[model samples]
Target: MKREIENKSKKKVIIKRQDECLRPSIPQFSVFEIIRATNGKLIAGSDDLSVSGVSTDTRTLSRGNLFIAIRGKNFDGHNFINQAIVKGAQAIIVESDFRFDASQGASRINKDNLSLKDCASVSFIRTDDAIGALCNLAAFHRRRFKIPVVGITGSCGKTTTKEMVADVLSAKFNVLKNKGTFNNSIGVSHTLLGLNKEVDIALVEMGTSNFGEIKRLAEIVAPSIGIITNVGYSHLEFFKTIDSICNEKYDLVKNLKHPFIAILNGDDMRLRKKAKTSKDLNLFTFGLKKTCDFTATNIECARGVLEFSLNKKHRFKINVLGRQNAYNVLAAISCGVIFGLNYKDIKNKLSAFIMPSTRISLKKIRGYHVIDDTYNSNPLSLEYAIQTLSEFDTKGKKVFVMGDMLELGKRSVMLHREIAKKIIKSGIDTLITVGPLSHHAADAIKTKKRSNLKVYSCGCTLEARGILLNLLRDDDLVLVKGSRGMRMEEIIEDL
Candidate 1:
């Protein structure tokens, strides 16, 4: 009887399965069919209909796949349209206003200085909203599956928190989590389209630099449980104010109907107030404060593991760094508790979770400790990373290598300078910075003349790598941090 049910379960996935021959409930449209669907006015006699799947890169283009030529700020996709075709792309999705062929009646410019109208295998579509079309396809694909989706967003800790929640849930559930930072409009759509029907739970992380991004992601996943980790100084450049960012972050809750579960930070006064106006929502909160539903008391961080007592009922231990991560662990525990997992089961599962790559990952290099927190950084996260490093209690001086915290908007100078003061207060002995904004931090640190603190200015990680290698000794501990664009991982490789 169990075997029969298991066999039936395996048939739901749209992707190719080993056991069953299912044609995937999700639609696989040919180039001609998509052109017909979109009413793409081709110049006649274009019959190419090959498609393997959707792709954004020319290098990854496979035979029978429709390559989406998205115009980026730096590069135009129309330039690579021919490359995609040469690499075996059956169809091409191009911008409506894009002039691939300057010649009259030509759909695209070819290497032979001719029109793409002559190519038998290439077909082009002019769409006003290519991203919208992708979103529509992804939404349609997700409707066939009955998966409990969990959407996570916040000013900080969204990725780490999402991973922690997914790991805990995966102990008893077949979980499908979004790949690293794949939480935006295109990223979320791809993640949804990648989902198979057999996945019991879908854990999706939604990130935003500007307004409405979370709304766009939430509409696709429609997560049953929405989690906002905390509101902090992130993406201030896009929104210009904390209130604006708060409003944007709350976009996830705004779209959901009544009877949705919201896991929020009760400690955040702004969020606590916002939770009040949200009607018909079952609100659950986890934090250090006593008012929280899943409060942690008697917290302790020892030997790279955080142990905290949950609501005075159970003591949970998670192998992660910092007190901030302890909050993430508690958030994951609350998720499990809502799903009907007992305290022991939640603790057992959470205990197995390790720190994610590029986010506070610890490695040993010739007996020296290297704390790699170079994943992504904001002012709030940088403080947490600094604090976590200080607690390591190393005999050698504690070192901090930071990079520019992007998207701070008008507050960039103030926040960067403030971090310099924080480095001194945190008792960091050495401070190194990369990029333009971070140079302000390095200057501020030097201005204070706290003889113990050695400040170094490197414009990029390559230059920073030279300083980092020279600073590290046999017993010294180092902490690396920066935003995604800073590429702090390169320095970690050198260390």
Candidate 2:
């Protein structure tokens, strides 16, 4: 079943892959158990009522479900209490500060007044913070299961590495993973809550834009294993420096259990330095470097697929695009080794790794080979995408449609111009910019006055859409990418 949980930031997390997570065969949770898990108080109903699943949004609540009333910047779940009750929510977890507002559909309950039974014996519980309670209950639920939970965080390839690790683990285990970019506090909680009797292990991707978020997610997940893909220029608006980003990412390793097993990119100098000084974590290094614990050599990308040899003996061929993904693959291979899976099993499962199309995917769209990396963008990811596009053996011209990269704070323009320098050195023939910041890249390119490179600077995607429809030719290789807020995917849709 599809579920959407709106966190405090108003991010609507829509679960796409039902089979991968949120299994129907879940362990049962009673009202009393939730109270213990969340440190919540039973306000008006008996503590004996039980539920098999929990939901934050009333729109996705099912019969016999326990709905947690969440408050967000744009919406509040307490206002939808009547809808959840009418839809057969067995219990409700509301904030302790909530008061009865029948006009707004708020549920009224008190210690002496247990008669508000709009539904059959509905239970009501109160907590200081519903979101914290949700995370706390998820943490409590995670401890009940005895399985290796791998928590991954990095500026790039968090989702890709999560998928690759899940694919490898699935060879010998019933692996569980989050759907889409559900890597924030609420997303990780929902993913942990998806644990059931059937789940052999869980892979939780931790994503953050601010400090302390990764630490909070790590506490909620309590993973046995951890991975940091790499540290780079990502979300600099909240974290103004690379050192701060490194410190934030190290939170995953720091919050992992004592004597933790952390798989990290040895090529990232910060991570390697941290690994050298780590006292609690048993670090495993994976990269193309020969000094790494798990090294990948002989890397190649052909027909938009990555092929590499692990430790120069075991080979891996995956469908994920870009040569940079060899690092992502090596991270998963390290985790597979940690799982005690044989080299042959890891090899057999490597082929099953499918690149999420919304990420760095190469596709034949409208008669052209299109690389739709429109899911999100940062300086590091965008630079690699440009390299992947420029190196691609296409029969026609190479075009890059870049949108504004968000959250860079003061360095947005400088980073954009920096991408322009990279593009100028590459084989790209045409550059089309979608938003204001990327226009800086286009302007930087125009100053060179090179006849071989053509530039189109637009104020928005609507302007770029019309130009691309007429400019694109058959057998062309096009790269469309931008930050999530810019909605760069609209250009590909028009194409």
Candidate 3:
């Protein structure tokens, strides 16, 4: 199950990961228990009831429990409040200020006094902030269980690294991991709620587009181990600058108070410099640099597998693409090593790591090569995808199918142009840009060379798909990438 919880408060928390985290003894709350927990301060009304599982949606609310009616940007949960009651929700938790003025023509229309069966049993609790209250409850549940957690955050590779770390650690422990990008407030909260008593380890990937998000996630996960993949330009629209991005991403690291194990990319000088302040914690560094604790030397990318020797371990192969992923794999390996896994065991498990969807996924269609890294993109990410595409073995031309990199803010044009220059230098034979912002990149490519290299600038995904289908031959290698908003993965399906 996927869910996220965020704390808007900026307070930093310091804590150690405990061994007894995944105890299966579920926190069973009765209808009366919830009513009593929120009695004096939670709501003005005295109605109290209990149920199973907290829900923000009326459609999914279960019987005999609390239904949190939260107001969102697009939809209001209040509209479905009655539906939740009919669906078996015993109590409702609405925002405290939610008012109904009978004279305003809003209250009498819906008959606000509708009661449930067996006379005034359904309870309604009001809170100033439903989301915050929910987060507090999740944190309370976490402390109650005492689960060991490893929280990971970065501008990129958060999901991939989380999966790798979980997989590597799971080879030994019964691990519970946060699914997908469920690193936000709601996602993190839901992940914690899913935790039963049997889980031995919790691996959560914390992602943030703005400040204070990771900080909130850290409070919920309270990881003893923290991993920061190399930070890059992601969510620039929300952050406005790279420095701000770095500071926001480091929010999780600064909050840890345990014998906190920090795994950092030694290659990223910025990240390395930041690691200095974290010196009080037990630090493990990973990169290709000779000075690092875990370093990869003699890296080679052949076919779809990448072979690299780490700390002189001769035989290590990763199923993912890109030399840049040496950084990602090194982080995962460092985590395994810190957890007391032998070098040989870590090396053997490296081969089991698969690229998550839309991240350098290689496929063969009608003898042509298609590299689908279309999950999302930035100027830096596109450059790495180009490098990976350049290494693919193919009998025919190399094709690049790209979409606009969203959230770049003011630097979108310059960044797009750089992508164009890199593609030209990488010897791409064809370029199909899916959105208008990508015109800058395509124009840059057209300025330098004209050796039968086709640059087609399309207005949208449908047009790009048409161009690619007509232009690609049976033996060409095509790499598709774009921001999440562009939905570039659709093109991959068409191919």
> Candidate 1 — what's its lDDT?
0.76
Clashing pairs in 2: none
Model 1 regions lying over 4 Å from their true place = 1-27, 30-52, 83-91, 98-124, 446-449
RMSD of each: 6.2, 7.9, 6.1
Query: Roughly what TM-score does model 2 have, to 2 decimal places?
Result: 0.91
> What are the per-residue Cα lDDT tens digits for candidate 3 across 1-495?
211211112222233345554344444455455544434143323444446677777666667646777677898777776677667666676776776332432333346544423123556666677677566666656666665578888877888888888878877778888878777887787777667777877888888888788888888777777888878888887898888888887777787746566778778888777778766766677888988887889999987888888777555788988888888888888777666666677777778777888888888888788898888888778888889888877889998888999988888888888777678778778888988889998888888877777899999888998988887888889999999999998988877
Once fitted onto the true fold, the runs of candidate 2 whose alpha carbons sit more than 4 angstroms away are: 1-24, 101-116
Q: Which candidate should be chosen as best, given lDDT against the real structure?
A: 2
What's the lDDT for residue 228 in model 1? 91
Ranking by TM-score: 2, 3, 1
Per-candidate local distance difference test:
0.76, 0.84, 0.75
Clashes of each: 3, 0, 20
Between candidates 1 and 2, the lDDT winner: 2
TM-score of each: 0.85, 0.91, 0.88
Q: Alpha carbon lDDT of residue 132, candidate 1? A: 68
What lDDT tens digits, residue by residue, belong to model 1 across residues 313-335?
A: 78888887788887788789878
